[model samples]
Target: MADDEGLSNEVNLQQRHRKERKELQAQVQKLKHSIPKGDKRKKKEITEQIVKLEAELDQKQEKELEELESTTNEPSKVAEQLESLTTVDSDDVDVAHKVKENKPSRAQKRRDKKAQEEKEREKRIQEETINNLMGSRNVESETIKAILDKKGLQLFEIASDGNCLYNAICHQLQQQGTEASNDSLRKQTADYMRAHQDDFLPFLTKDNGDIYTSEDFEKYCVELEKRPVWGGQLEVKALSHVLHKSVEIVQAEGSSLIIGEEGKHCDSPLCIVYHRHAYGLGEHYNSVQPKSEETVDEFT
Candidate 1:
């Protein structure tokens, strides 16, 4: 066995099975003999023992037979011992019972659901704010891009404090600007970021995400006034246009006579084009109503 790598190990298993069979047979015979022909107590003990031994014997026989038919060299002496773990007889499961026992109680479930809903509502608001910022016309692309590229604790720092880029740019254009100061400028930037958290954070993600200009940020702030709706589904751009006085309109969806002049796309093509400038004349950020659907007139 030490020298041969591919040895057929069968005799060992056969011997083990034979030994077990003999032991069980001996035990069964002893129990059968021990029971006094008319003694009730001794007969009960013998009967219980006989039942146990018979079950064991049946199990051993099945295992030994399976081993004899094996081809993959699995050990036959320790054949798999399988047993029914549960005594459940029915097919239908009592969901309500399981829910009562395994799941959260009614009050706990309500609390959990409330927490989840609140979280989702906050998230939706954040999403809408970001979209409004992206769509706003007040801010510039380069300014937003530079802010987003800034990394590390600097983001938090700026958010808490603010940036002086706008001020610096203004000063430079006036020809009264000096070199950008490290400490002072960073502090200013941090202050600005902190002041405009809702505007900036919504558009910012370290990875590929929305980034908006100062105008967009302001627009979002305006929308915060008389904000409509249950949650924030509308993006910051739409919010800024309506809530904040930002972005101009090139064309708008004028009313049509078709279908009783319903709305845009009712009896016309999408002719609405808001101006791409800050301070749009009459942009309103009201709740976006669900579009009305139409039905075909059927006749026999």
Candidate 2:
């Protein structure tokens, strides 16, 4: 029986090794195409890489097969090891086995997502602390506040999650009885950036302040839509261009910065106040609301 099991294991190992070898051969063929024609150095380098990969795979297959053969040679030893592991309470063993069996890919994804969110929450708290130590508090100049008050605009705060900019825009749209979500806003922003790459790409830079390449720009747009990346002035500008709505940013210090063609957009614009440092935390966005006396329902 031990000999039969060992033979079966050897057969399975051979099949796996064959599959791996075929894959490596295909990879080598692809690499051959990429090597520069008439360049001996490039060809030699690619050939070396292919040989090294094939050798490694062969060595790994041999080692695994040898280990399996050795392990299955002594069935009594294997049984004794298994029996030792099973010596715990039967109920405990069953529960653990069931737990492992019942956990599907979706369950693992949910766990990973929850852990990521928790990490983000903790990061925000730490950032908030650092911001406080740096004396970053929500500060609006008297002039801007007076202008807003006189214009019958009230400030409605949005949560300072990474999605603050999108949430603020979505909230504005929802207030006017139009259904919108952060995902939709992000998609729109990404699409607009991609379509108008030339106009925006010049302004975008890497951390080193070098102008971003076309490929880098596309990658940035992709990550912007997929990840919980923080949105800033660039995102707001992109949203403005896509929505064809002038986004009036009433800042704490300077005059209001309006993004987009002033006269090309909507009649009643989408406006948000930009708090450089809001709630002693990071920069945040808040929907501009109209005062109760002057009811405004103009968000198209």
Candidate 3:
């Protein structure tokens, strides 16, 4: 009787495990289908969750099956006792068949194959994207380096933080005997933009593609002043005006920009290199220095 009770409890536990696993599998499928298109970051996060859940379910099922097998090693004795005590029905025979037939159904096999193909396809696309990006970056870096070499200049490495643009500008300023901190420069840039709202507001836009309202402009300035927000062409223009100096951005290709060309200090403009793929994150900037100024400890 005790052996029968133990076997029954084990069967019930297995059934519960199967039900929970089915529910989790259904949830994973739903999450996959509901993933937002073109949102790579969100998609990656969801994919991680799905992978974690699948791993946990597989591990739990394996543990439960191992335990069940260990406890039922004397299956012959249990079967003889059950036969002597109770009349086994067709349901018992069906359960025995299910336990023996551990292989997945044809439908499940097809689903697994489809899932594997999709996973491979995604992996291939990701690899190709990375390869293309790396190839493009290498070409750009070589082109920029050759151009800089011809001009007797080289890249001075800058930190890849959001404040890279401001830091690059500060480096140039410091080289020219003008000491300025990144925080001070950010404040000055924001102040210039705020004071010249008419000049900057038209160029800025809201998320919905509308021109920035006065409130939006104020909020932008506040964020720029207080946050480590990335500076772009708009900020470059404002900073040029604030510093009373021209800002020249040299790029790998195309015509480089020369902001504030009419400034009094245009002769010795602040020179910085713009890289579309210098960093994995996104756009980056580095100050330009004379090749002769390169030091042993300085990162180029």
Most lDDT-accurate candidate: 3
Model 3, which residues run further than 4 Å from truth? 1-134, 265-267, 295-300
Over 119-200, each residue of candidate 2 has an lDDT whose tens digit, in order, gives 9999999998886556535235344577688778876756555677888888777767777888989999999889889878
| TM-score list, all predictions | 0.20, 0.50, 0.56
* 10 residues in a row with least lDDT, candidate 3: 291-300
Q: What is every candidate's alpha-carbon RMSD to the true fold?
A: 30.5, 17.9, 8.6
Q: Best to worst by lDDT, what's the order?
A: 3, 2, 1
When sorted by TM-score, best at the front, the candidate numbers are: 3, 2, 1
lDDT of each: 0.38, 0.75, 0.82
Give one digit per residue, the lDDT tens place, for model 3 in 145-255.
888898899888776667889989998998999988889999999999988999989999878999989999999999999987778999999889888889989898887
Question: For candidate 1, lDDT tens digit of each residue in 58-97?
Answer: 5666565454445333454223211131344333235534
List candidate 1 stretches off by more than 4 Å.
Answer: 1-8, 64-300
Top candidate (TM-score): 3
